[model samples]
Target: MSKPAAVAQAAAPAAPAFDVARVRADFPILSRQIHGKPLVYLDSAASSQRPLPVLRAVEHYETALHANVHRGVHSLSQWATEAYEHAREIVRRFLNARSTREIVFVRGTTEAINLVANSWGRDRLSAGDEILITHLEHHANIVPWQMVCAATGARLRAAPVRPNGELDLEAFRALLHPRTRLVAVAHVSNALGTILPVQEIVRLAHARGVPVLLDGAQAIAHEAVDVQALDCDFYAFSGHKVYAPTGIGVLYGRESLLDAMPPWQGGGDMILSVGIDSSTYNELPWKFEAGTPNISGAVGLGAALEYVEALGRRAIGAHEHSLLEVATERLAALPRLRLVGTAPAKAAVISFTIDGVHPHDIGTILDSEGVAIRTGHHCAMPIMELYGLAATARASFACYNSLEDIDRLLEGLRKVRELFA
Candidate 1:
């Protein structure tokens, strides 16, 4: 079940893209049963199951080469450090970032955002300066800005979206002014499936001389992200969401921007020389990393990324699109069912509310039926309020999921409807 990690390190095999039958073989847990029914993991938007290669890589490191990275002058440190840095290269390639130096590993997306807000936002923001974000942001994107505003006397404005869950570009344009310092937004919404026009948004933001930080937690895995192409100043995502381990994520920042931001935390490896009065910092990414980084986690992340790269993003996306289309059609056919996000384009996420059923109630029933899905505002409350609901049930698909999983989800929905009726 492990990814051909050694093979992945070498040239990729000439494999057909979008081979779901073969792709399913990599994820070991996809074969399990729950509640007398086969497990159908339709929640990759929250977290993806690890492939055999990724699992094996993690085990290989822990068993043979487990050690603290970046400090020891020993052979184990060199091995672990190489693994960790190689993992960064894998991530850099995954995002098409310019350099591995631009990829700073943090615990996950939340820490990545805080690094920017506290380190960059705090230093740059001033009283009456405006920070723009969208209604579709996850709470991680929202709360950090709120703190920045409170600390610096800057103002936070939410760019409104339409009822169809599309961003109101006009509303966003109107909010932009001379004082706008930073524009933070989600590349793809977690609760709703709307894919924001981040490239266009970035273009606009850059035109105004404002830098944009994209909350790429949901978007990075579902779509091919090119930080250089999108020209987003910063793009952040969690490895756990991309079939890697928890406590590992990346912050892909523009080299110049990263060079300017100070370290949010003052600790071990982040510093060069410390004196009674002052201290100097390390270069580029290490300055921000600050502590003994997640070596094994990073190695696992690299392996997961290798699996993804070998699988081919274009084919993976096409397969996901088919699954999403089928699920959307099936769910939309139900009476009393209202989809929360109906953008012209979306990732593998589908959010909806059934009349007279709280999303949590629906989720509970589905879980009992051995179906897993997400419920609640999905940590993006402003858009939930905009839709006039407290929460929605979200069924997300990953590469390993089959059409049969969607059918099971539909069956569970019908049963819920019957109970209500």
Candidate 2:
């Protein structure tokens, strides 16, 4: 072979096919500077930055197809309704839910949880019944059930986490008793980035005749989710966490389960007929979705899912895992840095605290260095309490993140240490 041919052959298998540079280009904000330094956004677990396609999709909806969906017969209304329903179908495919009837759009994970807590819990739960969550759960998963417990006189039971930050699976399984009405857990822990064994959790709950709801706000972007394969009764995720707009999320429930549950909120769209007497509610999904939904946000979420599909989730997962390894190794080497979650299986998140420095102080220093990280309890205060930590500085990775971003984070941590010392 010629020299050029050999060189080309060797290089062909050297690089990954998924182009990180091209992916980064899709997000315009990645190019901007923060405090005169290039922005290193490591807070994707909180809310990912929107790509150009998602932005354009929202803009197109507002400009060309702005109408009240499902309530009008005009051409524009028809177009808007088509777009809105198409977005629901996209969510259905994204989660591999059985039908569009299973998909319910809500404000976000918080509202979705509230929907289940109010609708499902109100019916199935009774006094002394238990809801099983985990120490790794975000507040969205925790608080709704707490409110339900308070309202219905049911009790909330939390499974513990191991010292390494992984959920104690045996303990979780043991918690599944006949009195356990529902099992609500996060598929991925936002604060610790711990990937829980959700499939097993679902199976265990099902064996005990309890329905499981997997909170996928952090898991949706990191992996492919199949509700059928997991056999979860309910799953919820926020669009903003997956590079879509805020104020829109999805709740996927089994059609049988959703049909049995009453409406969480009564509003214009959720009702069928309202006379002087009682009113009839809408069908399965719409029965849960009240009032005017976040139509533009749903369109953007559909576009974001399409964008992720084009990128290929397996490739994105591999790239993100590689970044996590790089960040973990680099961050672990820093002096006086204590990593919070040391689970063997984790997503692209690192929460750490430097000795003699508060997490907020670390956050401020890193912010000054143009690296964005989440500081504090990260809405999982129970997990913090379990770990005996008030807060930790968290840096989460996404498809657009690079190893260079990790380097910048390391540099910022060094600066933090220097300032503290």
Deviation in angstroms for 166 in model 1?
A: 0.4
Residues 93-116 of candidate 2: C-alpha lDDT, one tens digit per residue: 988888999999998988889999
Candidate 1 residue 65 C-alpha distance from true site, Å: 1.4
- lDDT of model 1 at position 331: 92
Looking at candidate 2, what is the lDDT of residue 354?
Answer: 88
Where model 1 places Cα greater than 4 Å from the true spot, the runs are 1-17
For each candidate, what TM-score against the reference?
A: 0.95, 0.96
Instruction: Choose the strongest candidate by TM-score.
Output: 2
Q: For candidate 1, write residues 1-421 as lDDT tens digits.
A: 3443221122345542355666777788888887877777877888889888899999999988878888899999888888888899988988888898899999999999999999999999999999999988999999999999999999999999988889999999888889999999999999888899999899899999999999999987779899888999999999999889999999999999999888989988898889989999988789998879988999999998888777777767877998899899989999999988999879999999998999898988888788989998888888889888888999998878878888899989988998888
> Worst 10-residue stretch by lDDT in candidate 1?
3-12
Over 4 Å off, model 2: 1-11
Per-model lDDT: 0.88, 0.89
Model 1 alpha-carbon miss at residue 394, Å? 0.6
